[model samples]
Target: MRGRIIVLKHNTPGLLRRIASLRRSRVLQYRDAKGVILLDILPQGQCINAARYCSTLDRLKEAIRRKRPGLLRRGVVL
Candidate 1:
């Protein structure tokens, strides 16, 4: 991946959600538009504040379920 770099900002939680899915790494960041992410990626076996990460993951899962409405979550539960 060698090319020019780009940046983006938004008000909703879309960007963070996408990044969490693609990278699978916890990213605690805040942009100008503002995304108050408690946890970016809840990596396997990472116990960095279990309570918050679990909550964040739950919110993300709920959002996905609500939007997709047909995505059967089997096997690894996010």
Candidate 2:
């Protein structure tokens, strides 16, 4: 089944500060046709698999923590 890709852009009003930041963050949320969250694309280009068949939010966060140690520290809340 083809899923819908939702890109969550950072809504912070500081355009200059966002550009000046070292890491250009991007969050992509994938959902199925029924509106169920499948997975998420985190900053630093990491994909967190949160599909209904496998994996959960906590597991995904742990995976992210392992992949990018500095991501959580940068104030990016998943």
Candidate 3:
């Protein structure tokens, strides 16, 4: 399984709620020294499938779309 990193501009409460709601067993969180929070969405277990990866990306995209659409266009990844 591979990992997908998603970086957000700021850690907003609404964004946190969206992430918490969509977070799965494979989802992990981290923050850098600059206080930038990153969500590492990875496929679980030994096998990596498209559906899992796509779903994860879709969920995150939807959450971002609902909260901050500008981030999506401006490139959310760091």
Candidate 4:
């Protein structure tokens, strides 16, 4: 997997979310040759603990359902 580094002048929180929420805006996503599949963004200075990890997994499952409907029905390797 690759990591993305976002540079911001301000240190305040919620700025990223605001920009992402704009009309027709886009958020970082996990992609493969097929196309975008999942979006999982971790807030600045935040750690991925159990609760957050579980929720991320839930979001990933939902994304798969929408983006690649047949993926789950067939079978996913990982």
Q: Compare the candidates by lDDT and give the number of the best one.
A: 4
Per-residue lDDT value at 48 in model 1: 63
Query: Over the stretch 31-54, how does candidate 4's per-residue lDDT look in tens digits?
Result: 656865665555455677899878
lDDT of 3 by residue, 10-78 (tens): 665676556545545355554435543336545335344698667756766666666565767976444
Evaluated against the true structure, the overall lDDT of model 1 is 0.49
lDDT by residue (1-78, candidate 1, tens digit) is 333232444335576456545553445442212333323544555656778867766776665565543543544533
TM-score of each: 0.35, 0.30, 0.37, 0.57
Tell me, by TM-score, which candidate is best: 4
lDDT of each residue in 1-78, candidate 2, tens digit only: 123333334433654344335254443344334342333334465554556225556655675566555657979655
Q: lDDT ranking from best to worst?
A: 4, 3, 1, 2
User: Distance from true position, residue 51, model 2, in Å?
Assistant: 13
The per-prediction CA RMSD against the true structure, in angstroms, equals 10.3, 12.9, 8.7, 9.1
**Global lDDT of each candidate:** 0.49, 0.47, 0.55, 0.63
Show model 3 residue runs off by greater than 4 Å: 1-26, 30-48, 75-78
For model 2, the superposed segments whose C-alpha errors exceed 4 Å read 1-55
Which is the winner by lDDT between candidate 2 and candidate 4? 4
Looking at model 4, which ten-residue stretch has the lowest summed lDDT?
1-10
Lowest summed lDDT window (length 10), candidate 2 = 1-10
For candidate 3, give the lDDT of residue 58: 73
Candidate 4 whole-model C-alpha lDDT, 0 to 1? 0.63
